[model samples]
Target: MSAVPISEHVALVTGGARGLGAHIVRAIAAHGGRVVINYRRSADAAHALADEIGDSALVFGADVTDKDAVGVMIDAAAEHFGAPVTTVVNNALPDYSFNGDGRSHADNLTWTELDAQLRGIVGGALNTIQAALPGMRAAGGGRMINIGTNLVQNPVVPYHDYTAAKAALLALTRTLSHDLGPDGITVNMVSGGLLRTTDASAATPDAVFDAIAAATPLRSVTTPAEFADAVLFFLSPWSRAVTGQNLVVDGGLVKN
Candidate 1:
């Protein structure tokens, strides 16, 4: 639980309709934080989550890659919540999978795939950050959390394009921290390994999970709910002076 109540702040989680984003949204609400659930297409799921979260949760559908839509989302969230959004969790993943069963090898990899990721992750992050900056600045501060992956540090799966984009996002996180800190805003990242079961990782083999668990200090795979909790720390007053840090939450699968 956060020592400082974020109940007055509106926290936005992009792609919050399902997967890890969904869990993150629920956790934010559970901690008494007002939340905005941004979804690209998962309309039904978004609405269901809003109903589950009651009045504290607001659902908005917008493609994160679109600058105009993202701006609209930020404005609507502030209007609906009667306050500027103070925390942003950039968790919207483009079309990518962690199955490892069918992936492009180094020789067969193409720039197109990499471009897609850059467009999705880096582009989306930029669009959202730019759109939300004014409100965050006027409010005197904010927190921006980019959902990263341990694969960049460990390279356990060689998810080339995805890893590359996240690495780029991490760089963005650090640079933004330097730029945004003076405004009393904090920027950081939360990195996780291949999660147990998300739509993207559902095709992953059991043997791989067992191998990961066998080597991890916790002796278990990291769950979405468990990972979601770590995100709150950055938004909490406890991290008042913290910025430009990457918190890895993969049950010790990758130590950095």
Candidate 2:
């Protein structure tokens, strides 16, 4: 696809080192926008991707749960990329934990596990959004897209913690939209079902993949690029009037 005309716009994507996050970074940069790729631990991978993207992309490291670090990351991005970060995508997760581990039964789940999940998905989003608000408001308009999951709608697997965290993120998206709407900031969500073969879903069993594909109306798994395209729509002018909504791009896996 040809690049979108996002020249001079700056975008910040958290957890942008690999998997779906990596696709987002490339997508934004390909569209001619400057991107701040945030990574917590994948320094090498982050730098490598940034290098591959050339000058439009820069990698920064920060623990998204740490407000101070998040602030620093945003500030640095603004200084380096001349932000009013017109776009922000929150796609980071704490760790890759599959619900199919068989150890995730309600009886085995712990507050500690739930807490960590919340911090990564919800807390991280709050931190990044809070940091970007000033610039977005100053710019007169912006887009904030949160990465969610279709599991909340039709959870074939019982990934209680992950789904719960994303549900909370959807709530945050609505609240932020109303809170920032008057300021011309739009907040929305792009939720997806089982995406194929990304690092995040690498642990999913072959049988699980087959079942998900069969269950989907499309009878196939979606790609990370396809999911990224949905996110791009939210960032584009076409979605300027769309906010506080969750757009599911899960190949008809969930009709709602």
Q: How large an RMSD does model 2 have?
A: 2.6
lDDT of 2 by residue, 160-190 (tens): 8888899999999999899988988889999
Q: On a 0 to 1 TM-score scale, where does candidate 2 land against the true structure?
A: 0.94
What TM-score does candidate 1 reach? 0.96
Candidate 2: 10-residue stretch with minimal lDDT: 1-10
Clashing pairs in 1: none
Cα lDDT tens digits for candidate 1, 84-175: 88889999988876657588889999999999999999999999888888888888888899999998999977889999999999999999
Error of 2 at 187 (Å): 0.4
Question: For this target, which candidate reaches the highest lDDT against the unseen true structure?
Answer: 1
